[model samples]
Target: MAEAELPDPPSQGIIGYLKMVGPGVILGSLAIGSGEWILFPALVVKYGPYLLWAALLSAIIQAVVAVESLKYTIYCGQPIHKAYQRLPPNPMTWAWIWTLLIIIPVVWPGWAMSSATALAALQLGRLPGPQDSYLVLAWGLFALTVGLLVIHVGRKIQRTLEIVSWPLLILLLATIIVGVAFSASPSAWATVLSGFAGFLRPRLGFPPRDQINWFIVSAAIAYIPAGFGFNLFMSSYARDKGWGMGSKIGYISGLIGGRKVELKTEEMPFNVDDPENLRRWRGWLKVARLDSYLFFSGLTMITLILTTVMTYSLLVPRGLAPTGFKVAAAQAKALSEVLGGLAWIIVLLGGFWVLFDNQWGLMDSVGRTVADNFWFASERIKRWAKNDPRRIYYLTVYLIYGVAVIIMVLSTVFKIARPYELAATGAVLGLFALMIAPILQLIVSNRILPKPLRPGIVSNIIMIIGAVFYGFLITAMCLQMFAGITI
Candidate 1:
């Protein structure tokens, strides 16, 4: 591999490590929303934590994938999408397919609409009623608007994320811990521990007749923290934050009309053969790994276990499952039930922040992914948008707003499906990216990246395992859609 320019080594020390922690925190904050607050709890309440193994397994698999994907961005200062576009045979085609798979399913308006449901439930005694129809729409619209505005108000995207994510992440985790502590019993602890131990011997056990269809539901939940497109977007966040090689490419502007910039020659890839450069690269890798486990996987596992335990202790005994529009509200009420009205305030405040952040973070990621893909796929996009990241970024954001608003309006008017159900279904669809992302990330990491910079054999093996696991779920989902097989 020819030598290219490289960025300075990541800062070494407590402050330096702290600065590198934004992306994972942002991802963790988003993960705490629908999946933790609603789906995991609802499923555990009905299924008795029997499938806790899936959550444990999924987090490990995703962490492996996340590290490998970050390698691409850290090495080349480019997101995986651009690197995936360099794949053999038909890079553009592969990029197109994955881009669509990641963006479309995720934009299903489930999170925004679900936030509205919880807000309505808070204001009224139940989910949105006929008289509260306008208020519900306002709630959903408000979330979308705030999310869009937050990103636009600032010029540096990374700074904005750091300011918002860290505080919210801490608050969200504390609430879940407190909520679970107040609600748990010895038996509930037993169920959680047993299910976690079940990780050694995973099974699809007989599908539940009365509770959630764990077979399909767990697949969706697995995609929350690090699976689905969430893992892939981490590369962008890292690159934009100027970590390692990402510093070369710089970052996109957060404002809609921020000044335009172009990549400089020094920001390009560096020669792996250079010993000093290689040592610096290794240093940055350590930083990335630390952030991955500490904030990304660590917080994710903590929140998932607590929420499951809390709900298991509270709802499983009564055979109650939170469903439909009241999903978030139900979780809050569960805590309130055990610890009284104060718990409701705690849970509700935490739940609202999480749901709102989830929607906001996702919209930013989806917009960035699409905009980045288009920027790489065609010179026409570059010319049309004048190579300005802000223009393309806002264009995609507006596009997402349109799709989300349409789904929100239809779901409100028709009442065909509940908000939480719609959100979970969208998550299920998002598993499509998980199936393909590992393969693409693996290919790019090995083929496009220099040999010494490539992932180790162990990393490669796990990527395959991750692919196969998601493939099995995707196949099962396909079979159910076509052949009516349950499990």
Candidate 2:
């Protein structure tokens, strides 16, 4: 593969830029699922709203990481994983590390199980019980199969996500907003707002050390807006959307509707010295930042706040703490108080959609990341797939879904873990990847890119702060789990 010239960016005003907001919307939808629906609410039920500040903080940090990671894609027309392979001393090592890191968290199928639980609740007219395990497992497997079919039939995998994301996100947000407006009291709203501001009227020592569950805390932080590796995957979405230099590199086409499209192995960065290209670069960067900050980060925070306030108001007063697979179910049952029987239908239905969309997005993203890394790291695989990245993509997707099925079976049949527990475990593991992502982005952005393209001092500082924040959380969790010491 030879170097290619960067194409001029599309000239877009506000409306045009809004039209190009697919990647961020998709990313935001991805975050809304397990994190907002499952973990954050679970935390609020146990710890109260005081710790909501952590959600805001995590969103801000991940937003910066999202932008920085996309820098590589904007400049080189390749995913950030490619840039990781460019790092000094054992580049292939980075590929293998990322492959494992991405696979571990995503393969657990937590979102699917959660989605299925919601469906089972909907069917049973109440929360599902131990006897309903088979029903949940059946629904989970069906959901996974539906996801696989959706991915296989689309023209482009990312485009399919973007289409599914927009409507589902709007519906989910609208449902939550309406539920919160009618269900949450003014006092509840005030409490949540204070929590967001870190005021915590009855301040409980940040997390009230005695009551803290480090695993849930770790998962909550890692998923405030989105998980660790998913931010890196944002670059791949940008590339496929033909943003900046990414316009030059072909994307991964879907198996059925997609005509043959070839992804280039080599990167093609624009010459920083060229003034015209520099202007185009800035224009593209501005668009990307808007999409990431406003759509991805902004929407995530809005969803998180709305859901937390609603859950805090409705569930807390009744002393109802949703546990096990009842996280979504409990919220629905609470909403029924104010909204009546309709609440059950609305909440459970919306919860199912939120979680299902999340599972679909996760499978697609993990498939892309794992396939891309394997192709980049292995010569034999690259040659075998050769220009048809979809071969590896579909294969990886099937393999991941197969593993997920096995995991779901074990959980459902053997009773190893519940839906929320599986999600929490995956999230805790995701912390390791979250801790490393910013550092990796900082290195690639500063070292590989041209001076004009490198991140500013403020961005660099935020990345370092994020890295340290996650690093500290991971260390605390490990100590608590292994050494029986709580932080």
Candidate 3:
């Protein structure tokens, strides 16, 4: 090939590095879910980031599991966007029959908007007969505004995400800054250090007064099913960039080989290819590592660390959101007692984008990919979904969201509210099972993928330990829940 024909030198250098980091970051950032960033930070403000150990431990275990899932999709030809299709379920379709439950995340906007009422409530504080009502009204208005923006300014799929992440990233940073600046105290660091200690030993539920309930933890774990989407998203982004493997993968970054010269230098988060990795690893370890530190230690670990810090810095004291707040208002009182509400506010924004968009965007894409890969569909249908795919998951997510909110509201109002039912009803269990599956897949990937692509001995140990620790923790949580101490 001519010199011009040769691929650009991957726009390497510091700026190029961030570009590579984008895709993995999208998924890795998933580690900052509503639970950790929002609820956890809220917990921290209320308790102090000292419980960061719980957040850290949870994030570390889950990140290990999440990266492995994404790795299977990226290097292996497993399109995780619709991994549910391949998971050995059959003889019956849980999705078709359980469509009601599937829609929880879809209609999530209402819940988000309801939660977002904080902006207005804080502004209007102690000003009205019913502040929460005004908050809900504000949520309705916010959703409409976001919808209009998505409809008008976001002319294309990619454009919309750009719009979303711009605010999401900005706000995510704001949380860490504001919470630390405001919430920190003489006891803060000491508490945080002690909190980190909890990372090693995860107690199932919140401290006694929080009354978090067993169902809440279940809800957090339920998203494990959603982890599959990240794998598919990162894999496609990896393929788009070209270096799905090597130091690039290890760094947990994807290289976008042919973008504009100026754009190339923006953020090359990728780890360049390395022969050394191929020499030392094989199977799942190799496949999971993709790009030296990029995919594994570096990319995944950054997310885990950020999660731990964010969790400690925010969640432990904040009280864990609506449920936590209920406990506080009924049991405690005073917002000052809750920490980092603003940090949590930012986290909620990020969570909404990461989880919702990832699901909606990838659902359509995954459905079409699977159809082409396994089924014999009409060329037109295949082309449409493949080129501009959309699927049932989006609608399901949207609708179920509406139901979940209604249920939550009713439960809260009627005093018959077993809102934990949303999670107990199933999703979290699926998420946990899914987490276990990746560790299994990692072992399998090691055996299945080419010898050169395997994970390192260290990676394998880390993953194995993750699997064991999470497994044991879940068991304890279950036992604790059953023991009736009231989480």
Candidate 4:
């Protein structure tokens, strides 16, 4: 791809605005998957919506981080990790360490396992147990295969993500909204409204030991929308979409034999010497923020609100707490109660889509991140992925699904919650990245980006808030890990 081949600037007005919104939908759809559907609601059912504050605060803070990260690709056609590789004092070390810590957990098979459990319960009465390992493994592999195939069929990763994501997003919202209307009572609606008010002032507190679980759940809430590591993937996705200077670098091709495109391992910073280029850059930046705030952050917030509220109305009242395979069946049953028996099927279908989407999004994003990071880290690593990242990408996908299948089999054999544990562990690690990513972004943006493109006071302020907010959670989580402080 040449510089002149950059995506044409949008036409003026709302139509132009709508066109700029495509990339954000991919982000939003990825954001609203298992974490919003499974983790957030699960937590809400157990502890109510007082912690809704975590989701609200995390979305805004992560939005700031996400925008800052996007600036790299928008202006320079470089993903955030490339910027991180430019960090002082052993950038390669930082790249490798954070890569393993962040990507492994997020892409782990727990999500596929969770979704399969739900599918199994919907088909049977419950998850596959000691006597049913074959069923769990088959269903788990099926879900993983479907998601992988969906992405493999399309030519461009961005287009594929958008195509798959749009229907899944629409289906989920429609099913949930209709379910809410049919089942949620007048009082249930009122409680949801009041829950928003209650979020402002946390009226309830956990006991000393339970704080560990509280922090664990809070970490998942903060990360469900945008984790520290996933933010980088968002930048990669934008780059692939030809958002700004990113257009200069072409996209990844589909799994089938298509035109093979490869990004040069070297960095190609956007030349902003001319004032006209700067003007166009600013326009692209506005488009980026619009998508980041309204679509990526905004849509995620709306979805979380509905899922949490539904859990409160249906599961909390009935004293149901979703764990392991029960998350899918229990939530589906709650929807069935409101929308009738047929609605259970809808919920199950939605759950399966969300889970499959979640797995697909994680596998693709994390795999791309690792491949990109390797490709940029050193020339030797670049050739290791065969100079064509699609190889590394598919390899990573296979490895992730393979591991997840093992987790499913183990869980079935032992009747344990291994997938959930891996997911929760990943969430905690991802949140730790969330705490550090903004601080890194703040430093990188000021150091690398030109004065005109750097973040302003308002963005910096939000980044600070994000750092402090995520920092506190990380501190508590660390203390819990080391000091054996339960809470």
TM-scores vs. true structure, each candidate: 0.93, 0.96, 0.60, 0.90
Count clashing residue pairs in model 1: 1
How high a TM-score does candidate 3 get? 0.60
Clashes of each: 1, 0, 77, 4
Cα lDDT tens digits for candidate 4, 310-358: 6677777788887644665776776665566776677677677666687
Task: Please write out the lDDT profile of model 2 over residues 1-487, one tens digit for every residue.
Answer: 3444567665678787877668898999888888887788888888777777777878888889889878788888888898888776665787778878888988888889888988888888888889889998999998888887878766778898898889999999998888888788889889887877664344432576687878877887788788856877889999899887788888887887888787876788777777878888888888789888988989999998888888888889989887655766787777787789999988888788888888778888888887777766777887888657888888888888899999999988899988888888888888888899989888888998889998889999999998898898899899989999988
Among the numbered candidates, top lDDT falls to 2
Q: Residue by residue across 1-487, what tens digits does model 1's lDDT show?
A: 3346566655888887886767777887777777777777666665557667777767777777788878777787777777777776565676578668877777777777777766766777555666776687789999888888878855577568768988888888887777877888988888787876654553553244343363446444555575456877888888878877787676777674445667331225787878888888888788778777767877888888887777777776765776643545665676676677777666666667768888878878877787777777767777888877667778878888888888888877886655666677777777878778788878878888889888888888878987887787776666666777756
Cα RMSD to the true fold for all candidates: 2.5, 1.8, 8.9, 2.9
Candidate 4: Cα lDDT at 262: 73
Distance (Å) between predicted and true CA of 254, model 2?
0.4
Instruction: Please list the residue runs of candidate 2 whose C-alpha ends up more than 4 Å from where it truly belongs after superposition.
Output: 1-5, 199-205
Report the lDDT of model 1 for residue 426.
74
To one decimal, what is the Cα RMSD in angstroms of model 2 from the true structure? 1.8
Worst 10 residues of 2 by lDDT: 197-206
Off by over 4 Å in 4: 1-8, 125-133, 195-212, 271-273, 324-327, 416-418
User: For each candidate, what is the lDDT?
Assistant: 0.73, 0.83, 0.39, 0.72
